[model samples]
Target: MSEKKSSLIPKSALTKAWLVWETFPQTCYNYERMMGQAVAQVFSCVIYYLYKNNPEKRKEAMKREIEFFNVHVEFGACIIGMAIALEEQKSEGKNIPGEFITNLKTSLMGPLAGMGDTIWQGVVIPILLAICIDLARSGNGNVWGAIIYTVLILAGAYALSYINFMFGYRAGSEAIMDFLEKGILNKLIKGASVMGCMVMGGLIVNYVSAVCGLEIVSSAQTYSIQTNFLDAVCPKILPLGATMLIYYLMSKKRWSSLKIIALIIVTGIVGGLTGILTY
Candidate 1:
């Protein structure tokens, strides 16, 4: 490939493409194509610039990008950047196969999605939420907590997107392959999972409140089941048990969130009326 053709994709075009991706990555999201249309949308300008002289090639390039794609939004920027690089090479008259690009995208999306979800959803969000929840509680549910969380989340998302996108563009598939080969991605996922579990445990202990109201009254004296029995056996056992039960219902029984919520409401009402539970 000639040097000029290699540099056909100007930086300005890439900036615009990134903006497009950030703004409307899922505007046409559907089961049929998932994020395919958005991928094509992100590259519309770049593709046009690369293949303006050849209408047939331009159409083919657009069609190539608009294939089935689904990945985590933040980390998916890396894939988009790689796709742009591949498109540039193809435009430079290199012998890059369309199928190769498609297959690469398909293969990378799953692993990246797993990593993205684990790190962002599992670790980062939970920690941030734990802090923000505490802040809100301390402030009696003030909007400052919400506002701070919102600002931090938006800033973090955009920053990660830009960094990953730039890295992928400059480093290409080789860098990602190196990370995978070295098991770095796996370590990150595992670490994030552990951190997520720890944060959740803390949240449960602090947030979850379940008190036993049951008491046994005898001729001589009254026995407080909660204080004398449950507390003696385990502190915060009810909260822990409740959390585990909910987790089991969701994970093992495949119960929907709405269904579980309904169950909680019913249980709360029944337990309160029967005087078996409080708080």
Candidate 2:
């Protein structure tokens, strides 16, 4: 292929966007990483746009563009950005630069994973659920409250994604560095962690401590012993104990998550059938 045609076709923004959208869903579980990838794509797109608009600024733009897409560890936007850059470099016959870019991208994956788990899964999801449930309960079981909360949660998620994407794309690498130095991301992560912990405490008291049936079965006499250990020692201990047991099994034993879920379901079914538990 001719050099001009090759450069034009290979490093286009459309191609980078397509790659990001396609890869994002597959790696959606890694929220931070995905965000990084998204940011990366934004960076690439911005660079591509700049190249088209002003060919003279290409080298200078490339030198400083990495910072615009820098995300707090879990932002998958970096991956997308790096991938696009790598592709462009390959097309332009710059193998060593492409490898260096790849290395930089790989280095950030771990930190991003941790941040994503703490922020998105731990804090944001729990807070949203807690608010929705609280509103629904307070509204005399009005379903609309729950619906509204759900919409808010979705809106928050999408808004964050869109803002990050735009910031990365428009400002290039400098925006990311600025966000980090200002400590905005750190504060947000910390806030989310606090909220998540609060929600978890509430959940433990409300959902985790419940026990439905406690009377023991007797065939010959009308004698019954309270089967609930919690009632004997302290009320609402069964759910807490169950929660601890599950936590221990999963964390200490390193059991598979799927297996733990199946065990919980099966145990519940058996307990209900044996009249030891009730809804």
Q: Which ten residues in a row have the lowest lDDT in candidate 2?
A: 1-10
lDDT of 2 by residue, 203-272 (tens): 8777664455646557865422334354677666667778788889989999899989899899888878
Residue-pair clashes per candidate: 0, 28
Per lDDT, the best of the predicted structures is 1
lDDT of 1 by residue, 130-243 (tens): 888778878556878888899999899988988888777777777777878899989988998898888888888888999999999999989988899989999888999999
Q: Which has the greatest TM-score? A: 1
State, as a TM-score between 0 and 1, how close model 1 is to the true structure.
0.93
Alpha-carbon lDDT, every model: 0.86, 0.56
Candidate 1's C-alpha lDDT?
0.86
